[model samples]
Target chain A: MVKVVRNVVCPFCGTLCDDLEILVEDNHIVGTRHACRIGNAKFMHFEGAVRYTEPLMRENKKDDFKKVDYETAIEETARLLTEAALPLIYGWSATECHAHMYGVELAELVGAVIDNTASV
Target chain B: MQDVGYPVCTLGEVKNRADVVIYWGSNPMHAHPRHMSRYSVFARGFFRERGREDRTLIVVDPRETDSAKLADIHLQVEPHKDYELISAMRAVLKGFELQTDKVAGVPADLIYEAVEICKNAQFGQLYFAMGVTMTRGKHRNIDNAISLVIDLNAYTKFGLMPMRGHYNVNGFNQVLTWVTGYPFGVDFSRGYPRYNPGETTANDLLQRGETDMMLNIASDPGAHFPQKAVQHMAKIPLVCIDPHETPTTQLANIIIPPAIAGVEVEGTAYRMDGVPIQLRKVIDPPEGVLPDREILKMLIKKVKEML
Candidate 1:
């Protein structure tokens, strides 16, 4: 039997109306109810877009993109972040509170200026 | 409870009690289509049985917008003159004698009429959007509106709400204030939160060639930022953490896939009025994808390892 729970908040915008209901079937979001058009699109977007199966990197002047492992990408990203003198960690408005807090720590450790997209 | 001197009401109350709905520089039809149908003038509330007929809709904008077309009074005030217009309205409300021929394409007569409607309403609510804050005056414009609401209380019941762009943007501001003791776009690089919008804003940092690297969470700047700021982001070492591929992600040197919060992951968020809400996870994120929280934790650990 599918389990249904009400008052699920959709974190897509500032309204944060916690009236959405989720239909879980065998540990899957088979359907969603009581969400707006944007919320519905957000909930079901994964089924349409390519899930970024592999990490990609660009190689030369030709802008050749190559798929790499997740570790390699994360390491490369970390190197870039650490080496940065005035790093600006931007765009955290859509993330959860836990992620935002961790991001704060990362910014403090690297002495980077954390800016959300709202600044624009 | 936080001490808010001003009287505030939920969207539910606005739907029920608001007899005069004034949308200043906001297009709810496009930005918030459901707002009218669910919570404002058009909604069928207990007090408002006739829906549109029960409430007076007023729109004030520089242009004759879609919402303005349906308004009983559409005050097309000049752009960048929001402060002047608001001040003029306040003067009118206080029964100040007219000293000028006209202000911002709005005559003295209209100002008095506007103030009259505001004063006579049983419940008056003002909903403002980016148009009030994105222009040359920015925060000053909002300050005027807030001051107006404060002044309105002397006569009748009045309230104001900022048309927050995203669902959790207010939540973010609230959380930032709670943790860092500042609100919106806080800078913590100096081991403390600094709250200066223009100076500490991301665009200002990038345009000044001060920022070296960037880690974009779910928000997208490339889609909205100016050319100069966009160019800066392009030249910098950019990392993106988002569920979908966006315009900003196209230029990112590193892209981290994060589970969609509220859909694929569970978390807490805040509404427009600083009300906390909980998101329930419904779907599984892609096989290798991680939640933004988990990804940031990993990134923090890696950084610590490097140090």
Candidate 2:
């Protein structure tokens, strides 16, 4: 079964073509219409089977990455940020403003600088 | 983001009144497939009488692109010679011939023909992208392209805009400018806005080995940046915040999977031409996985408490 959702904007490029018709079935984006090749690829792979659904950790004592609890991972990250003298928090081109503001606030709290994909 | 003033118009205006559409150094067919079908060729606008039949399409590039194949006129100039061709076109429009019979590998006749097309159009729109901005003499190439449009105003109503990349790239530039007083590369390490592209740009700093730790959000520098920059990223303690798996994820010490903006999360984004639009969610993300802002907000609180 297919249900076409209309006027879906493509978030890939700056064109932001909003007349897209997505074919959804069982919460999976089965197909799309009125979009470019890039948009199709992005939509087609929206739900990745290999996504990291849990917090991961590569602690100094451990030789390999270990799946850890979310709170533990956050605490580890906070510990690292607190220790680093001049951290570089970067990459914000694909996110929203509220998130970018949070990133900035995090960077500022640590007296660290922030950049974006524009820099790289 | 510069203070340079130029003629500006919305995409709606292009659809409504533009009789001649010029794609310079861009292949919208591959880059922006629906641009022609929606805005220039097939849009049922107020004055466009018969869709594509009422308009003329022109393409200018060093090599023929997929989009150029559909052009009524294609000016295939030499690579790294766009500045010369643009200057020559400007000179021709002002009723002057090039000192050489051929300039930028294009014959005098072809130059004149392109000049004629630009001059005769009732409402012409020039859309250019990285071709003019990324090559040698980048700024000069843009200056000449803008100058050509400015010159064309004498004969016809013309507007030109950069084919900006990314749905919200302009949004970052706009928002950063409004809040921080500078566009892309703004530094606040000193607790104030410090603006300098070369000095503060990501790759430059990475190449120079300036940063100790790197937190990458929503962008994959490992995939797009040079191997040297990526190598630098690998050496540092890297953190990634994105929805999908990319090469950057491989080097990341911490990979935070945030809810996909415009997909699992709703927010506002700025289009290439500075038009703001709201993004609607199509589905829910994984349970407990929050939006980018929420995740960052979590880190902000933790980082602040630690600080």
TM-score leader: 2
Q: Tell me the tens digit of each residue's lDDT in model 2 across B2-104.
A: 5344677888888989989988888888887778888875676789968788888888888878888888888888888998889899999999977887899
Q: Tens digits of per-residue lDDT for model 1 on B1-307?
A: 0223335678888888889999998887777656777788888888888888999998989898889998999888899898899999988888897788688888777888888999998889998888887776877777788788889989889998877777667666666667777666667667677767778888898788788888888788889888898898888778877767778878877777777777778887766666677777776777887788887887887888887
Clashing residue pairs, backbone N/CA/C < 3 A, model 2: A119-B202
Model 1: how far is B266 from its true place, Å?
1.0
Q: lDDT tens digits, residues A12-112, model 2?
A: 78777888888888777789898788888877865453666776667442256677766776776777777876677777777666776676667667766
The native-contact fraction of candidate 1 is 0.62
Per-residue lDDT of B289 in model 2: 84
Model 1: residue B280 alpha-carbon error in angstroms: 2.1
List DockQ, one per candidate, in order: 0.55, 0.57
lDDT of 1 by residue, A54-95 (tens): 566663313755777667777777888889887888777786
